[model samples]
Target: MSVEQVSIEDLGRELGERIAETPEYERFEEARAAVQRDEEVQSRIDEFEQLRAEFMQARQSGQATNEGLQRVQEAQDELHAMPVMSEYLDAQDELEDTLEAVNEAISEPLAVDFGGEAGGCCQD
Candidate 1:
């Protein structure tokens, strides 16, 4: 075979071998999996946001009394312990941090009070 033809064949084989050995392909697969996890987490976050809005509205409208606040708190607790991928743990941590900030903002007195009602508050 001519030297040029032999060199071209060797180059193609080396390229294939290098591709097989590269870590980037595995990393890419991992990243794709992580992205899927993030997408699921995002959907959960949207649901939580909607639920939170409803809870807030109920409290604001005096529909949710102390019993209602307890229900909301229970829901928040469930959300705080939501499932997330290990690869996307950072994203979950960020979400937790954001929720803490929101809690702090709503921690002030007279902010959506749920007092003066001792009755049953059920949400279905």
Candidate 2:
């Protein structure tokens, strides 16, 4: 009897590409750009810290805007969509952290702060 053995390396390469081509992967790629800079993800831990500080300051100063909040939410969404592969997990973590910081930065601020504030009530 002959036995067939599959090497882990071969399996990994095959699976990696297959998984990377999924719609989810495409979404991940789109969302990831928001968090990655220079091919390196920002430190999530530091992002959280900065976020907290900024949030507190913004709220205290009453400088919050809707756009700011939207930016934070976008980061949060990106974090949720980040890739889960072992090789990419670290980068994901960085993105998550940066998102947290972004959230803090936008908290207490209206989304309009980022731009394009809705002007006047619509009467079309």
Candidate 3:
């Protein structure tokens, strides 16, 4: 079929489906699942999130201290030091790299960057 025969949304959906079948995506999914199943990692993530939230709240209320921010950072560092979390982060990076390559391929043929310009303004 001609390119004009298919809607851009349909093409985008097909691309998404194909991406989901890729090895990088599969690895990322598996790693993420493993992270979810690890109780220790989950507990650490929860603690870190709680610490971050409290720090944010304190900052908003003008009561945040340097020590509070340092604690949040330390908690984050400790969380990332876990083997499961490391694997998940690596998988995530690989998947992001794959997506970036795909974005470049899609953007190369167009006058404007497909991923950047296709949003039609109001992008954050």
Candidate whose TM-score is highest: 3
- Candidate 2: segments with Cα more than 4 A from true spot: 1-5, 36-48, 51-124
**Per-residue lDDT of candidate 3, residues 1-124 (tens digit):** 5665888999999999999999999999999999999999999999999999999999999999999999999999999999999999999999999998899998888845765668677765
RMSD of 3: 2.9
Per-candidate Cα lDDT values, in order, are 0.57, 0.55, 0.94
For each of the candidates, the C-alpha root-mean-square deviation to the true structure, in angstroms, is: 21.0, 18.0, 2.9
The list of candidate 3 runs beyond 4 A from truth reads 1-4, 121-124
Pick by lDDT: 1 or 3, better one? 3
* Per-residue lDDT over 1-124 for candidate 2, one digit per residue giving the tens place of the 0 to 100 score: 7898899789767756775665556555755555555233455534545665676678789997776666566655554454432325555555556545544555437544222334666724
Per residue, candidate 1 scores C-alpha lDDT tens digits across 10-93 of 966775566445454444445447556676566756766777788789878878677656765776566546544333455545
Q: What lDDT does candidate 2 reach at residue 31?
A: 54
Give the candidate order by descending TM-score.
3, 1, 2
Clashing pairs in 3: none
